[model samples]
Target: MKNMVYGAILALQFLTRFPLPVNCSMDHNTLKWALRFYPFAGLAIGGTLYLIYNLLNGLLPLYMLTLILLTLWVFLSGGLHLDGVMDVADAVGSNGSTEKKIEILKDSRVGSFAVLSVIFLLLWKSVLLYAVLDSSENELFIIAIPMMARFQALLQLFVFHPFQNKGMAHYWKQHLSMRDVIIAACWVLPFAITQVTLIILFSLQICFSFIFGKWAVRQFQGVNGDTVGASIEGAELWNLAVLYSLFLFGIV
Candidate 1:
């Protein structure tokens, strides 16, 4: 249990900008465990956001809490995955063959399509958040959004092959054992009970992301870190979009 908590903190430190002191031994094994525990680390992030939401509640308006949480949420990752989503959008939007699109994605410089895509995604997400902020479903949002994003990230383990023989997958692809799967399942089960419909919707979105990611991976000949990050970001956005629409329909 101590190891798992340590693993969780290690995952949180790697995934977020939080200033937690966790110095694990620099080893391939440690990296793999961290990746496996990544979803659990998300529990910490969601819990923190919830605390902040409640804390800011009398001091500021709901919109302000929304803005603060939204900004911090992306920044927590240092906007790493968001950048990947932008690059992917640029590559896909630009008229090109598979090879060309992959090349565009690999380029370090940000293209016009990338800029527009990021702006649109962020705006869409914020608007969706605002629309659902006052709904009866808002509490569910606090739990689901972060959990869904983590689930999206975890899905990459099953959906796409790592592009390179090196990088994070060099560690994760090996350590994702049956135990890891059980752990992830345990993590999401309670949330599933809280809102079964939303969980189903969220699962469907994740499955869609997996399919899209598989296609993208095939086009690019397996998935790189960028593509994996893009998958998570896309999943997060799609989940929120579905939830917001459901909130309008008075669906729990």
Candidate 2:
């Protein structure tokens, strides 16, 4: 029970800018439990977004509101995943050897590819959010997708080998278990139950995560923090796009 409480704190502390009631240690046991709470962190993010939308929906124009939401969306994570997107972009865009790519991933400097990738990422997110927000579709998806995106990150454990036996994954992999995954999966059930129509959305994310997971395996040769973070950002954008598409096709 204590571990679960600490794990939830870790998830919120590490994943968001939200202020917390207390601090927690990041010991081995607590860190392992952290993966199970990743979904909870996501749920908090989505819920905040929904709350903000309600507060500002009428006061702000759709474009401004969408930009604000997008800004907060990135800001909430302290741009952690965007940093990953940039790292992965620079690494892959270099079109160099695996050794060279891994080297780029480690470099703290940003590159042209990183700049361009973020531009496109934000642009696409803006467009998609505009569409979704404008539609009469349930805004709950704004909440669900972020949680699902984090859930997708947790999928990294099951998806590929570690690029090396090092970093946070080393500690986390030690504690990775079916129970953690099951707990995380349960975090997703509430959204599905809330809207039967979202069943399709949930199924699509599972499929997309695997397909993207396979691509990451081939690209990086294994999972690393950059690839995993990139996956989270990708899943978030993909989820929004999926939501918009569903709205477009009258599926939702």
Candidate 3:
């Protein structure tokens, strides 16, 4: 029980900017269970966003509300995934060899690609959120988005080989057992089973992770922490886009 509580704290500490009462321990054994609590952290993030949406809904213009929500979303994660997206953009844009690309990812300097990527990603998410907010039925689905995103990240950790021998990705790959994966899924399964639509969406997220894992492996020879973060951000956007598409077609 204590380990589980510490693991939850560790996950929240690593994944979000949320304040918690418990001190996070970095001991490898304790940290290994952090992945098990990742979905719980996502649930917390999603619930917070849901509350914010309800509180602010009707009080502001849709565009403005989306802008504020986007800001808050970024603030919550401390732009950790955005940094990953930027690093990935720089790597892909370099058009270098695999070794060179890895080097580019490791470099701290931002490039033109990184700047452009951030602009495009923020713009894309803001626009998508605005569109989703325009539909009343879609509001409730927001809580699932972050949860699915984190699930995709966890799936990647299980399926892909790590790019580096050190760092967070490698550490998680080393410590995350199949049981940890099952525990993470257990956190998400109830919500996913609530609706057939959600089941389909959940399946799509798994498929996305599979495809993404393959592509990441091919591109970098293996996935890294940056790619994992990038995958989470990408999954959230993809989830919104797909849900919006379904809404447009009157399928959901």
Candidate 4:
């Protein structure tokens, strides 16, 4: 329960400038420990965003609200993971071997591919949110999406080996176990039962992680933090695309 609280606080930290009592002190299971309860962070982000969406629903135009929500989200995290999404996109598009690929990802200069990818993701997400808001006023679904996205991230922590480097992923890789996986599954499963649509979205996200992570491993020799971020970002957008497409075509 304490860990879950930390996780919620951590999520708030990611989404906003809330100060946390705990520091990233590199303690035992600090990274893995922090991430183990990370899904709760999603709950926080989703809840806060839902509130904002409701508060601004009639006060602002749909596009403006969409932009404000996304901009606030990015600002909250200082665009940390999104930057990873951009870097990974740039590296994947470039002609390079594994070593060269990592070098390209590490380069601070943004490429055209990176810019294009981020723009598409932001725009796509904005549109998706707007559509969903139009159809459903229940803000819980908004919260659920980020919660599920973080849950998808947990799978990579358990399933894939990160490329060699000392970072948060390394910490998670070392201390994470099946017991942890079971625990996380327990928390997320009940939520899954609440909506068939959620079940499909959750299942789709898991499928993407294996296929996407495997592709990253094959192409880059192993997964890295940037690749993981890209996977999360991609999975969220892909899930949104599928859901919205179904709505657009009246399929589901």
Best by TM-score: 3
TM-score of each: 0.87, 0.95, 0.96, 0.88
Instruction: Write down the TM-score for model 4.
Output: 0.88
- Residues 120-165 of candidate 2: C-alpha lDDT, one tens digit per residue: 9989989988988898556888888898888877877665677878
Top lDDT prediction, candidate number: 3
**lDDT of every predicted structure (CA atoms):** 0.71, 0.84, 0.87, 0.72
lDDT of 4 by residue, 117-181 (tens): 99989988888877866665345567777667777777886798888767656656787787766
Candidate 4 lowest-lDDT run of ten:
23-32
Go through the candidates in order and give the clash count of each. 0, 1, 0, 0
Put down candidate 3 lDDT per residue, 1-252, tens digits, no spaces.
677779888899889999876776777667767888888878888888899988998899888889888898999989999999999999999999999999999999999999999999999999888887786464656778888899889989988989879988998888788888898998888888887677877889999999888988888999999999999999998887887787788887
Clashing pairs in 3: none
Q: What is the lDDT of residue 242 in candidate 3?
A: 80
Per residue, candidate 1 scores C-alpha lDDT tens digits across 1-252 of: 555556667787867778887676645556556766676666666777778877886788877777898897787777888888888888888878878887887788898888888888888877777666666434655666676677667667655677668766445666666566556756666776576666676677667667867777766767766777777667767777777777677665
Tell me the alpha-carbon RMSD of every candidate: 2.4, 1.5, 1.3, 2.5
Question: Which candidate, 1 or 3, has the higher TM-score?
Answer: 3
